[model samples]
Target: MKLTIYFDGQFYAGLVEIETSDCYYAYRHLFGKEPKNEEVLYFVNHELLGLIENKSGSATRSSEVKQRPINPKRLQRLAAKESQKTSLSTKAELALKQSYEEKKKKKQMNKREFMEQQKTHKRQLKIMKRKAKHKGR
Candidate 1:
């Protein structure tokens, strides 16, 4: 797992990436203001896992073969290179977009079902009113 925190025009945000055997998961969290080290540490320690479990809906699959552990110096260099990049990873962006689309589709389906239910309820009420009118005549 890796967390990248950066200032995003208006607010500070963190992008978390978790890579498993064949799947990759990404989650974004908005911190609003620049977070202090302690705050970031607290979030990682206390809230990160729960948030991942609850909100992580989509995972992207990668076909890359696993490699042996890297040398310490090479790992340090790679970390430095990553720190220089200010934007989120493309894979993370795609995963987030997919999750958003899934949520939107689910919401639309729920709304349609609710509207159908309301229509049926109104029709039932109308039939009852008509029956009462016929009885009065």
Candidate 2:
């Protein structure tokens, strides 16, 4: 298979025909040295950029990654996706806030409220403490 070699996705040194993906022949041909365990084809620094098709066989660039041109389509898609995600999160927070307000309104009890709720709260705390002790927590 033909692979376009790159250095940090920037320094493009054209393409070369290789017998296989991770073979010694390709590594030696591109890097001009035998491949190491760490600096293999798919590893850091030494990377097999991409495959060159017989029809569209052109991979030419030597600039750094930051200097490369951005695809407009990809940027537009990302912007739209981010906007949708932000909108959904905002809606969820609004719904949560509305529920919280409703609950707060319902819980606005008078001074002469039921003593049963206070009793039940004390009972629940006691039960929680007892369960914790029983479980050796």
Candidate 3:
């Protein structure tokens, strides 16, 4: 399960298996961007090193691809600012979208439950009416 990855003229140690498949997928999905299998392996290896070994140095491809220094703090702040520059209703819009999805799911569940209850009620009623008819005969 261990793999050796090459980065910055060095090979870093990495693990293939994790407690969850999501971890594997997330690592692959992040670095799989048109990368060769070898590159993906290397990327994951170096990524793990950056994470466990160096917080500031842990950025995966930013170092190899960007060819320039990218401050993580500055990038995060820029992203937040861009999101805020949208209309004042952006938060409301996001909330409404989430609620709409929840409403749809809830409505579907209610419909299914209602139908099930109706079927059970009809079955019970039929059983009672049959019993009454048989007793009167």
Best by TM-score: 1
Weakest lDDT window of 10 consecutive positions for candidate 3: 20-29
How do the residues 1-137 of candidate 3 rate in per-residue lDDT, one tens digit apiece? 24433332233323333222222211222332234777766666666655533333223332333336779999999999988895534578899888999999999999999999999999999999999999996
Ranking by lDDT: 1, 3, 2
Any runs in candidate 2 off by more than 4 Å, and if so which?
1-112
Local accuracy of candidate 2 as per-residue lDDT tens digits, 6-29:
543323343454443332223312
- Candidate-wise lDDT, in order: 0.88, 0.53, 0.57
Ranking under TM-score, best-scoring first? 1, 3, 2
Residue 71 Cα positional deviation in candidate 2, in Å, after optimal superposition: 99
Candidate 2's C-alpha lDDT? Answer: 0.53
Per-residue lDDT for 63 in model 3? 31
Residue clash pairs of candidate 3: none
Candidate with more favorable, higher lDDT: 1 or 3 = 1
Candidate 2 weakest ten by summed lDDT: 20-29
Return the lDDT, model 1, position 133.
98
